[model samples]
Target: MRSAHHPATGDLSLPEVMAALSDPLRIGLLRVLADGGERGWGELRAPVAKSTLSHHLRVLRDAGVTRTRQEGTRCFVTLRRDDLESRFPGLVAAVLAAAEADGVGGGVRLASDAA
Candidate 1:
């Protein structure tokens, strides 16, 4: 088990969050976590390389968009819905909503998924 560094809600910055979500693949992974439960990396459906996925997770964590917990050799990630809602006030929902409109998480990969 290991602890992943995550920015506190109050420490979240809009630019950082935007940079984190700018990638379509990260947005797709966020959609998976948006379901409001802890999801293992294997369950994320990211289809990205291990290194790429780790980079995305780190971005989200640093931006205070997600929280990760490690148990044994597995890592579980969850969206910080309430924190985001309180700090950014509907930002998370709005982004997910926009992603939905763009076909995110519908098993269709956006172009940036190739990154």
Candidate 2:
């Protein structure tokens, strides 16, 4: 297991959080991590390339929605559930519930999955 660190604690500003979610990829990653739990690089690469994935993760991390740490040579990503709750209260929960209500996990409808 990888141990990710947060430099600080608090809810991200609306703009900061929105900027992180601005990319379809980051939102998808959040869903994957939320549904699957503690995913590593290999598990996250299918939706994007390494470089692109890194960028997406960085956005999420900066916005305080996600955190990452080095586990050996691989980096693991996980949602900042506790921190988010402390900072924004219901923000993360609302997002998850909204996704479930929409019957979508990653905020997008797949071809195999209907809207």
Candidate 3:
């Protein structure tokens, strides 16, 4: 299988990262990933179609907010927590805290939450 392109930690741009986090759905995804565990693509749940979810994942990956690994036909994703922290210094934590304070992902029903 072909490998996915991930920008180097140094190559990650603030504008791109901010833009990627601009969407509520993407923030919801981040909230799920913030637990610091890698989650399979099939494991994520959202109100949108699979294609739309895929698009959001791609946006996060391209922006360097997350890392995606392909294992055979499955794709697993994890938030690039260390890299993001190193690059931006507490930005992820602040965003996540703010998201929680504002109930950002409260409406998005994740598969794990359904269990």
Candidate 4:
């Protein structure tokens, strides 16, 4: 599996992070990852094509908002909560809180939620 590029936490830029979070689909993905657990690529649910989803994931990963790990043929993503918090204190929590309040990514459903 080809490795995904993940910028160091200190290299995270506020503008890039803000741009990554600007998309609702990306925000929804973050909502699922907010629990601070690794989620398989297939486990993330959104009203988008698999290719589109891949794009959003790439954006987040590139922006340093997420970390993706490859194992075999599968990829798993996790929110870089600690890294994000360290780089920009309270930013993740604040954006999540706002997204929740605004019902952002409400259409997203987690695989665990399907049970």
Candidate 5:
């Protein structure tokens, strides 16, 4: 288990957060993180390559939305839940709501066919 103390202010840049959240993969990552308490990178089963997942995690870390720590050779990630809620109330909730509205369950969305 990795422990971290979130920075109250100026830790997460707004632009970086926006950029990180803009990508669907990153959003999926966030959703996954929300599931387990703290997750090692290996716990993720994202369809993308390990390199790609690394990039996404980096983005989230830089954005201050997540705090990562190295435990031995493995990296673990956890959402900066407190800081995030303090910085932007209901933001994460809204995202979760949007996902629910979009019909995503257990972080996976069922596809819809269009004509």
Candidate 6:
């Protein structure tokens, strides 16, 4: 199996992670994965089209916010919890907490928002 080009855990950059999470769609994905488990792309219930979804995933992967792996015909995505915690400590938790505190939830339209 060819290993993907994920950054070394220790080398995960703050700016890249911020850029990845700055998008609402990606933030929603991260919120779903906040509980610490892998989620197949099919399991996510976002309203975006498949292509937009793929773009969001690629941005997250490239920014080292998530790890994606192919399981035969299926692809699963998960937050890099350990890596993020190790490098930035409670940053992920804080972000999610703030989102919750702000009452963010489902039904937010991503496609309607111009990025």
Please give the CA lDDT of all the candidate structures.
0.79, 0.67, 0.92, 0.92, 0.72, 0.80
Clashing pairs in 2: none
**Poorest 10 consecutive residues by lDDT, candidate 1:** 106-115
- Pairs of residues clashing in candidate 3: none
What TM-score quantifies how close candidate 2 is to the native fold?
0.73
C-alpha RMSD (angstroms) for model 4: 1.2
lDDT string for model 3 (5-104, tens) is 9999999999999999999999999999998999999989888899999999999999999999998899999999999999999999999999999999
Q: Give the alpha carbon lDDT tens digit for every residue of 5-90 in model 4.
A: 99998899999999999999999989999999899999888899999999999999999999999989899999999999999999
Please give the distance, in angstroms, between residue 61's alpha carbon in candidate 3 and its true position after superposition.
0.2
Off by over 4 Å in 2: 1-5, 101-115
Model 1 gets an lDDT of 0.79
User: Is 3 or 5 the stronger prediction by TM-score?
Assistant: 3
State in Å the error of residue 109, model 5.
11
Alpha-carbon shift of residue 114 in model 4 (angstroms): 3.9
Q: Give the Cα error of residue 112 in candidate 4, in Å.
A: 2.9
What lDDT tens digits, residue by residue, belong to model 6 across residues 16-100?
9999888777788878788788888777767778889888988989888899988887888888999999999999999889877
TM-score per candidate: 0.84, 0.73, 0.94, 0.96, 0.79, 0.85
Q: Model 4: which residue pairs collide?
A: none
- By summed lDDT, the worst window of 10 consecutive residues in model 6 runs over 106-115
Query: What is the descending lDDT order?
Result: 3, 4, 6, 1, 5, 2
Better model by lDDT: candidate 2 vs candidate 3: 3
